[model samples]
Target: MYSTILCRTIECLTRDPSQNRKGDPGVTIYKIELLKLQETIPDLTRFLSDSECQRANRYHFIKDKNRFIICRALLKLLLAEYTALDISQISIEVDAHKKPYLPSHPSVYFNVSHSLDYAIIAIAENPVGVDLEYINKEFNYKEILPNVYHQKEMDEIEISKDKYLTFYKLWTRKEAVVKAIGKGIDNDLYKISVIDGSHTIPSSLVCNQKNLYVFSFMVNHNYIGALALTVPINNLDDILFQPLPR
Candidate 1:
């Protein structure tokens, strides 16, 4: 079931920008298994900028250091692939909210998220945000449910047969929307209502003054993933999923 879709994968837009339901915005998501990154790119540091290399060294733990290095390298590689630019030509900067962006290439928007051993990178022509979380079945979601979800959402979760699944699905949506807005998550999470009946369809909402469309999917049996786009997408087939070779 879910395991079948969890391969080292990248979800891409199958349709061309001209065929988009809204404006010409093409969004693609790439899922990478961090543990296998080094084997694929032995010298990831070569792809990273000097500042990024320094940041990688700042991590006290080796695993954390490797994760940062691998993620950045993969990002640069993917950006290069999409824009037909040299990896070194792509310069990344962060906004006041700490959202990373391409200072040189504003039209190319992207977001990155990783949980446990996997990382998901989403690149788009329009503003976009993505989140991937390893669903922890043992987590005591009840302890903070009220603080994070709207009253109606909490009621829906409480009444749902699979509370954990419901919580993660909704939680990922909130995270995706917040990231898409390019604003740091402050205290307004509970105000965002993401509990629409069907999980298969993209839902529209206005958050932090930005209109967004969010869609959720399972990365694997243990992980839940979501994507947020600034523009609406009428058909699910517009988004395509590709699994990287193991």
Candidate 2:
């Protein structure tokens, strides 16, 4: 249970030139409410490339298609702001592991995750990964325990006052780390232990000889969010949360 912060939500389109400048040594998390952006779907597509549009069209459902467009559009807008480039100039490419990146601006690192009605984009000066999950209290989590949680994490959750929250806390942590490492979730998640015994502070771990720091927080009572970074967070203020205008 890392210390949680009440996200300081703000409009995603708000421009804070100083807060998110390229090379700024910090992270900013942008939240977008997909359900609120239904009318803007057409406008959002203007920010995406032809390939992105094609990918969105591949989704079987309109909701999923719109969600992908919203996520990518907001991502391009945010990156354009940080890189001081026109949104159309941003060319996003993915690595062999399928983690997205800006080929022209290697220094600007980011990751995006969405669940249900919302999506989050985390941008940092260094490599970063983020995860957002809607807490489904009624979902059966026992079947996933063995495949995803480490033995220690399973034990900790077994005795947790709220097993559902604990499950998500650790689950998001693992997902964030894998994203940060540019590895897909198909890896052995059970081998990753996020229980560092240090509550209230970012958990530090070494993966593939890379030092990673993870922080978990509540994105409101309904969603659990986590961030993984290649560098340690020097100040809590380094992480900013700005929710897009509904």
Candidate 3:
């Protein structure tokens, strides 16, 4: 599954952006460059249709465009085959509380996160949620901690030391799980405590809850990542990470 995941990432967004997805003519050039990158994912090439191009154009913001491009490209990459308009199509409509979802491919669950200059797209066989945050600035941990942590957790790490990274991981993990459930941060972050770091995800998370399992990890230097997999994993090695093709 991990190999398949990385292979899919490189194969789907096979083209490179001649120019970054920033600045003027950004949207148009980005679309063109990305579409060209489709060469990387030879197997999924059949899925990118002329109609999806028209649909991608509806977005005007660069961030929105980038996200959409990755989403669409990944959709084709994931299923790795021709799909009917209704089956392959992904239409995002917020949940009751405004959580985003693609009812079209309910099984092709995913979550995307952006932190500073990086974008993370985590896709799963079932509903999934992901989030990443950059900790480059000094933040008011004292002020924000109360919002997300339970009293017991606060007591667990009672030190005069800085746990900024710890806090970010906790925050991101909570956000990822809640988002995966389509409840967003509106749910209690404290109720769902999970430890995160460079390689390990807390044991509590590995245990199945209504069939969902979450794994958290770090990327690059400053970003913290957490993925909420709707279906529990038999092995952590099954999760994969792949950089987008240049």
Best-fitting candidate, scored by TM-score: 2
Clashes of each: 1, 0, 4
Using lDDT as the measure, the top candidate is 2
Candidate 3 regions exceeding 4 Å error are 1-90, 160-162, 196-212, 243-246
After superposition, which runs of candidate 1 have C-alpha atoms over 4 Å from their true positions? Answer: 1-25, 197-210, 237-239, 243-246
lDDT, candidate 1, residue 7? 11
Q: After superposition, how far is residue 96 of candidate 1 from its true place, in Å?
A: 2.0
Sort by TM-score, top down from the best: 2, 1, 3
Against the true structure, candidate 3 reaches a TM-score of 0.59
Error of 3 at 182 (Å): 1.0
Global local distance difference test of model 1: 0.73
Q: TM-scores, in order shown?
A: 0.82, 0.84, 0.59
Where does the lowest 10-residue lDDT sum fall in candidate 3? 1-10
Question: lDDT by residue for model 2 over 137-172, one digit each (tens)?
Answer: 999999878999878789989999999988888888
Which 10 consecutive positions of candidate 1 have the poorest summed lDDT? 1-10
Runs in model 2 lying further than 4 Å from the true structure: 1-25, 196-207, 237-239, 243-246
